[model samples]
Target: MTASTKPYLLRALYEWCLDNNQTPHIVVWVNEHTRVPAQYVRDNEIVLNIGQTASHNLSIDDEWVHFSARFSGVAHDIWIPVGHVISIFGRESGEGMGFEVEPYQPENTDTQADKPQAAADKPAEAAKPKKGLKLVK
Candidate 1:
């Protein structure tokens, strides 16, 4: 499969927000791999302002977004996997883009046999068939 377009769109939106004199902010879904300040996280999600003055050494790459920012006078090294980023927008106007969360599938997992087939695992009744058949002539 081809690469995901999320990272490119994120970069573009960030640049657009800056160019429009708006502060860029990002919404991230917190996971075990996400490196962020726990105290600042609420409801398993965190909103971070990524304006030049708010963050240092910020880099938004294809795989992750890395940066350092101070929270309550404590500087933290934040690293968010690109897939966990829910959205990026202008903090001032709340105008930006939201992305669908893509589940991360590990390449080196040992539980292949233990895992059940995704389609087979779902109950067939979960999807109700059409109530009536179509007419054919």
Candidate 2:
């Protein structure tokens, strides 16, 4: 993926998984990437540290997410628990085609993905936002 499209890739992935009824895994497809500061990462995954992701279009569930991110220290993937997610933001540019995996509600299995459902499917829309990976292909 291109540099301009790296950020939003995660959000697209999350949406993709939701559309396909699958789960999105957080991963860094690029060799060089920045890591979200440790202090930013939290226990309940308050934020989806943009640095946590390596490529665009990658994503993960909002429920206590945990990932093995590369950050920038080494050439390998390191463990980044849900607590590590310091921020949750959207992709700034790209084809707008990425995806992420979030907690599925049995009640909203029939409804649409983007449409906010009743209390059953999505209890509170303001509860917490999930993280996404910005990478495709």
Report the C-alpha lDDT of model 1 over 1-137, residue by residue, as the tens digit.
99889989999998999999999999999866467888889998999999999999888777678888999999887877788899999988999999997654434323333322431222333111122433222
List per-candidate RMSD values in Å.
14.4, 15.7
Per-candidate TM equals: 0.76, 0.23
lDDT of 2 by residue, 1-137 (tens): 43333234445555654465443334322111123344434442323333324433233433223233344553322223222233333333222232332323333323335433221232232122333433121
Candidate 1: Cα lDDT at 129: 19
Error of 1 at 19 (Å): 0.2
| Backbone Cα, N, C clashes tallied per candidate | 0, 41
Error of 2 at 77 (Å): 7.5
- Relative to the true structure, candidate 2 reaches a TM of 0.23
Off by over 4 Å in 2: 1-13, 16-62, 75-87, 93-137
